[model samples]
Target: MFSIVVISNATMVPDEAAIIQQLFEDGLEVFHLRKPEADEQAVRLLIEAIPAVYHNRIAMHGFFHLMEEYKIHRWHFREEHRQETTKEEMMRLKNKGYTLSTSVHDLPTVQRLTSLFSYVFFSPVFDSISKHHYKGVAADDFYLEAEQKPVPVYALGGVDARNIRSAMAMNFDGAALLGTIWKEPANAVENFKLCKQNVQTY
Candidate 1:
């Protein structure tokens, strides 16, 4: 198992591209650019900020129109965005060689969606570090269902270096962190190192 982190859901961080570039340098396998409220130009500027070489590892969360113009090879759909898409639309995206992923908050949803995505973000495996009110579900709830799914189920929410190994041991194919990474963007590389170090423990 490995690890991933969703970028902050808010506006761009200072020296954002540099920080992201460093994450890539630190061996980040996938970079999720989730800008929930960014306008087209804002998204454009952010993508432009990163090097072209890293585009393939980027998974987009919004501003899909940019996909046509960028070389980004992966996409992420929240449940709301997912409701608007059809199987045919998904197949079309796959035909283009693009990969798809989405977020689900529960075990049943992950089971139902097992065949639809390259992977799914099964969230709040622990209480959210970014959203204090969002307490986590039992990790066993994730392990039990994920063990049966062919598709990868990434443990999202509250994962950090401390518990990443436990998450992998619980049957998550990988871990996805938000607050742990965003909490200190300047230290993101060292932070990612911490998670990977835990992963290596397994």
Candidate 2:
């Protein structure tokens, strides 16, 4: 299956929960909750606003304790956080049925983390839409085939409807959308739909 992962905006948006629920209803496979600035209570409220049925589809970037509370099994660790985690601890979490994921900037790191994470985000497949002055590698520069990687690799950063096909051509297992979806909150679902359509053709 072509995996379509939508990441939340760094800050809250109007009717965010409602928009999220709509995405889930529209067949969004996974949603990464990445509110780095929100406190536990704030995050809790947002999670509370979302239906419990969709909680399992959420990948919590922080406030992991809520996972147990909400019966969520997906967890995301940022690059630094993943580095600080001991192998034993990661294995412990895996043993308990956690679906782990993380981010990486290069292919070497992705190769090194093969077994530790269920999947990973390789960023800047194109220039970022949200962050300025961040450049992405040319698609031709990527040579690894999907079968070459130990774990599934998702292209992240600057992925949108126009270039999703390019990511798939580069042999990425999937793509993660951030700026493309949140750049205009009103178009989030439509943007996702377009990207999904592009990926489907691949």
Candidate 3:
């Protein structure tokens, strides 16, 4: 089965931690805690709201220092942060058992990725649902054989129940959901289950 990852809404949402905990309960294995506008204290409060048992399933996008207190071992770096992080720091994280990941927007970058990353998000596979006018490449142009990719790639933008199968058919290992899950926060769990069922039944 193709993996399905849920990315936290970029801004804080009401009952966000509770919603996330429900996602984990419903079999969400990977949750990216990506709140770009939030400060360390805000992020810390959010993390503190979630039960400790589910902490390990989360991948911290910023404020990585919280990982120490929460026992989170997964870390995801955006393109800029990935470029700024030195190899030595990454190695140290690796030695400490952190599972690292990063994002890319083009095929060349995907081909150039080092084995240091466990996986990477290749985004905007479809026009972004969350971000206005952030276009995705043509599906035909996006196709890259497994041999051409050095790291496992998960489709990141505009992914929802409707197009997850297409993403997998295009050779993506998985699809990550942001908009589809949070478009209507009240329906988050239902939307996720629908997306998961869509892939599983197809």
Compute each candidate's TM-score over C-alphas. 0.93, 0.96, 0.96
Q: Which lDDT values do the candidates have, in the order given?
A: 0.80, 0.89, 0.90
Q: Rank the candidates by lDDT, best first.
A: 3, 2, 1
- On a 0 to 100 scale, what is the lDDT of residue 174 in model 3? 84
Instruction: List residue ranges in candidate 3 displaced over 4 A.
Output: none
- Write model 3 residue lDDT over 1-202, tens digit each, in one string: 5889999998999999999999999999899999989888889999999899998899999898889889999999899999998999999988999999999988888898888898899977899988999998846555769787797899999988888878877888888999999989999999999989988887
lDDT of 3: 0.90
Name the runs in model 1 displaced over 4 angstroms: 3-5, 139-142, 145-147
Model 2 clash pairs are none
lDDT of 1 by residue, 1-202 (tens): 4556555546768888888888898888888998777788988998898999988888998888888788898989998888789988988888888899998887777777746589888877888888889988864544544356668888888888888877877878888877888888877778888888778867
Model 2 weakest 10-residue run by lDDT: 138-147
**Candidate 2, 1-202: lDDT as tens digits:** 6699999999989999999999999999999999998888889999999999999999999999889998899989999999899999999999999999999888778778858688899888899999999888755657566555789989898899998888888888889999998999999999999998887777
